[model samples]
Target: MVENEKDLKDLETEQSALSEEETSEQHDAPSEKNESSELEEALGKIASLEAKAEEYETKLLRVQADFENYKRRARMDAEAAQKYRAQSLVSEILPALDNFERALKVEAADEQTKSLLQGMEMVHRQLVSALKAEGVEEIETVGKPFDPQFHQAVMQAEEEGYEPNTVIEEFQKGYKLKDRVIRPSMVKVSQ
Candidate 1:
């Protein structure tokens, strides 16, 4: 009968230990679940912040590109303004140059008139030099092929030595400001 009592006490103690172990396992499972939820929430916040950062970076790049383009356009405009600044004043002086050229072509009748002609010639040369310094150039028309851009054909002539559609005579001189033709040469073309 004593042996049976001892065996019953041992079994009860074993069952109590097993129950405590099960309770510990249940508490640990809830703690693991809480930790997993916290980890998921932190990952979600990180992902949101990363997306916002990328959006801001893209906006910054676009703004920087726009600013660069604006700067380039402004620079181009300023350069063009500087290049063409003398265009209007040069245009106004071209007719005066033509008149001076016509005056130089007249014949002097006497020694007194010849001295006056020489003085006028000097003035005309000085004017031409001044214009040349300001980037003015005379367009060549005589003996060359007739180009509509630089030469305007006022009359057609039949000349034996020249080819057809060639410039035979220049009636009025043409001038260019740099590469641009301010006035086209008035010419006669051989047919």
Candidate 2:
């Protein structure tokens, strides 16, 4: 009877140990599930932050490119303004130059008139020199191929010993300032 009681006690102890181990395993499983869920949440937050940072970086690059383009355009406009600064003044002086040329072409009848003409010629030379220094120049017309950009065709004639569309004569002179035409030449073209 004592042996049977001892066997019963040992079996009861083993069963209690197994039940304790099962309770511990159940508690550990729930803890492991909680840890996995927390890790997934953290990873999702990290991905969202990374996406926002990437979007901000893309916007920064675009704004930087737009600012650079604006600066380049402003620089080009300043250069253009500096290059054409003398255009308006040169235009205003062209009619005076034409009148001077007409006055210089008249025949002097007396020595006093010739002396006055000589003084006028000196003034004309100084004006021309000033214009040349500012990059103003006359366009070539006679005996060259007619270009509508530099020459305005006032008349066309069938002339011998000249190619068609060639400039035969220039009635009014044309002037340019640094490759920009202030006025086109009034010209006769051969047909």
Candidate 3:
């Protein structure tokens, strides 16, 4: 009977020890699980923040590039304005110079007219040189193909050995300040 009582006590002690160990295991497992979940959440947040940072960097670079392009275009426009500033004044003076040339041709062999013609010629040459320095160029349309963008067709004629749609004649001269065609040439296009 004593032996049986001792066996019962030992069994109860063993059961209690096992229960304590199980309780400790349950507490440790929950803490580990919580720590792992927290680490995962922190990593996800960091990834999202990094993605947003990259997007902001790209947008900032694009804005900087657009600003640079705007500055460059404005600078080019200013330079062009300065270069072609004398275009209107020179174009207005062309008719007067043409009339002076006509006078010289009519008054040929007169000494007084010769001196006046020389002075007029020198003035005209100076004016042309000044315009050339300012980037004003004369459009060359004589004996070439007619282009509506650069030449205005005033008349058309059928001529021998001339291709159809070719420039037959130019009634009024055209001028260009630069890459842009300021005035189209008054020309006769061959049919």
Candidate 4:
């Protein structure tokens, strides 16, 4: 009877040891589950941050392209202004230049003092040459096609030989600044 009781006590102790191991294992499983959930949350946050970074990169590239376009347009506008800067002043001086030329021609009757007239002529030519070099050209409408953009038809005439819409006379000279006409030529067109 004493040996049987001893064997039963040993069996109870072994059962208690196995129950303790199972309780500890249950506690470790919850900790592993918490670690896996935390790792998943961390990966989700990383992916969201990468997506935001990609959006910002696209916006930055668009802004850079817009700035470059603005700079190029500003440069072209400045160049065009510089090219036509002298247009207004030359138009204002043309009538005075014509008066000077007429006076020089009128004084040609005094043949003995021709040097003075010739000197004035040379100065006038220099002034005209300088204006021409800066892209100022006179619109030649006489005996050419009459264009509304460059010539103002003051009168229409029925001519025997000239074609219709052809300019037969230029009453007043016109001027152009490069491709742009500053003043339209006053002309007589044939119908």
Best by TM-score: 2
Candidate 1, 28-90: lDDT as tens digits: 433435777867766765685576567557655755766677679889999877766677888
Candidate 3 clashing pairs? none
* Candidate 3, superposed: residue stretches over 4 Å from native: 1-66, 79-83, 87-109
lDDT (C-alpha, whole model) for all candidates: 0.80, 0.84, 0.72, 0.79
**Please, what are the lDDT tens digits per residue for candidate 2 over residues 80-166?**
888778899999989989999998998999999999999999999999999999889999999999999999999999999999999
- Candidate 3: lDDT over CA atoms? 0.72
Lowest lDDT 10-mer window, candidate 3?
A: 24-33
Report lDDT (Cα) of residue 85, candidate 3. 80
Quality of model 1 by C-alpha lDDT:
0.80
lDDT of 4: 0.79
Greater lDDT among 2 and 4 belongs to: 2
Q: For residues 1-191, write the lDDT of model 3, one tens digit per residue.
A: 35445654765675576567547644643344577786776676568557656755764575576667767988999988887787687678667655765665666587988888888779877877887777767788867888888899878788988988888787766778877665677898899
How would the candidate models be sorted by TM-score, starting from the highest? 2, 4, 1, 3
Q: Clash pairs of candidate 1?
A: none
User: Model 4 over residues 10-63: C-alpha lDDT tens digits?
Assistant: 656755765675476446433445777867756765685576566557645755
As a TM-score, model 2 comes out at 0.74
